[model samples]
Target: MSHENKTIRNTAPGHPRRPLADRIALVAGATRGAGRAQAVELGRAGATVYVTGRTTRTRVSEVGRTTETIEESAELVTAAGGTGIAVPTDHLDGERVRALADRIDREQGRLDVLVNDLWGGEHLLVGSVFGKKSWETPLADGLRILELGVRSHVITAALLLPLLIRSDAPLYVEVTDGTAHSNRRYRENMYYDLAKTAPIRLAFGLGQELAEYGGTAVAVSPGFLRSEQMLAHFGVSEENWRDAIAQEPAFAVAESPQYLARGVAALAADPGRAARWNGKSACSAELARAYGVRDVDGSRPDAWAYFEAAAHGGEEVSPEDYR
Candidate 1:
């Protein structure tokens, strides 16, 4: 499918007016998933977005997924009505990230928003075990995950802080999973949990650190995200995703990554968004309620709430039933 076909029109009742135009945004890891959706949504709001990732038309990353490319992401952003600049970047290399930031500084002279969505843990966790006992995964793989997931965000933030500080409404968003205090353990192997949690804490630390710089930092998670990978994994397309719900009940409430993307755009547009910052990790459903934006299906899916209810024996639904 083409990117233009994926573009969603704003047809929901009581949809708010466009508030972001001529803003500058940087969406790291924009090759796919939430990063791609966020880039397109920011573009839809009329922002010049810099979409950075390792996967481009010229080369592919270690993950080997080839459904999307940095160039394709950039095109989708442009189709959404904003300038999209695709810069192939391996976030592990600090110098490359710095160079991209320098170019942004030279050209735009300011940045309105920065989103760090870099993650490369899927391949590493393929054969890992996480049953009765936790085994120490390979230190090398663990460190690599940290490099892509955590250190990249720190380096990007450091390189772009100056430009972000120049914006009237500077926002730093850390894309992560779950809220801060959610004690639920991820069934994934050991390294995956550590990699994901580190970014959440980084957001907490940065939110405190950036307070004096007049920038807001917050961790945002998509609820049961129906990402491109997940859709393919379930053998379904977004247009016919409802068919998959017959196999997994939660699929009935699965949210598109674009829903979270719109939430990030809305947060960036809010002038007092900083007040809601600080260690707080929000889900797309919560942000949708707060921002009054509807999902493409016109129904907000609260995945966290569903999980909580199911865990507490409040809901009898099963994953298969939702599918």
Candidate 2:
């Protein structure tokens, strides 16, 4: 509930101008990481963003990290030149989500965008090291992860679809991992893989269901995102991120969550966005290259390319590798 981090800057040079003025957006899991970044970018693009999350100034979720609050996220959105509303909500509760939608309908009458970034997997992964088999992970913990990661998105969409349909160009962005063709067995964990894939499937189902409604739905993944939690896990700041790569090589190829945020904003602004829907998943690197946008570091990290290279026994790569 503080505006301490509210700062504004002019749009980046050579980037598209704001095209979402007066639009209403709902970013469902905007406490941190990609959700927070995307919500701020949407606000910068001139959309009133409703940031909903389990964590507020008064409550913290199971994630245990408190780098940002829903109120802080909303303030950042407002500072970016769009109205920001922080509504505390847990997507698992159907009534709570319905109430959120009701409030939006009463106030804004419609919603133009919906971003589902609900994920609470870190809590479930506790006590299960990488060496442990999938069965060693408790079934209850696995189900909890699925409930938070996947079912929450489903519930939020069901409640918000009415408002989204009211817009002439409704956009649904399901924050996920990897594009459709990625075949890697993500860390040899079945629950983790399922949790990550659920959002993509949600996007696919939503796209088909909303095709006739003139709305677009697609899954998007950030390219090796250096989220606040990840940075902390590696005990490194953005300025010192390169130092952590010695221990976790993936850090060398990381991109900020803002990169994907900008990508989502660009897609939301596209008039022909519907053409890119229909169950397809896209990554920030691919979207940036296609749309001529660059990350804050002035590089586009192709996640698929990096994984493909790694799969084929290539050496550890960095942002320079992509350029």
lDDT of each prediction vs. the true structure?
0.79, 0.82
For 236-283, candidate 1 gives per-residue lDDT tens digits of 999998888778877777988888998888887776788876556888
Q: What is the C-alpha RMSD of each candidate to the true structure, in Å?
A: 7.6, 7.0
Q: The CA-based lDDT of model 1 is what?
A: 0.79
- Clashes per candidate (backbone, < 3 Å): 14, 0
1-323 per-residue lDDT for model 2 (tens digits): 33232222232333345678757899999999999999999999888999999888889898886768999999999999778999999999999999999999999887889999988667566476244577887788777877887889889988899778777667888997777766355645777778788788888888987776667999998877889888887899888888898897666678988899998888888877898655679888888977787888887778667777775557565645764
Off by over 4 Å in 1: 1-17, 129-133, 183-188, 312-323
Clashes of 1: 14
Model 2 TM-score (2 dp): 0.90
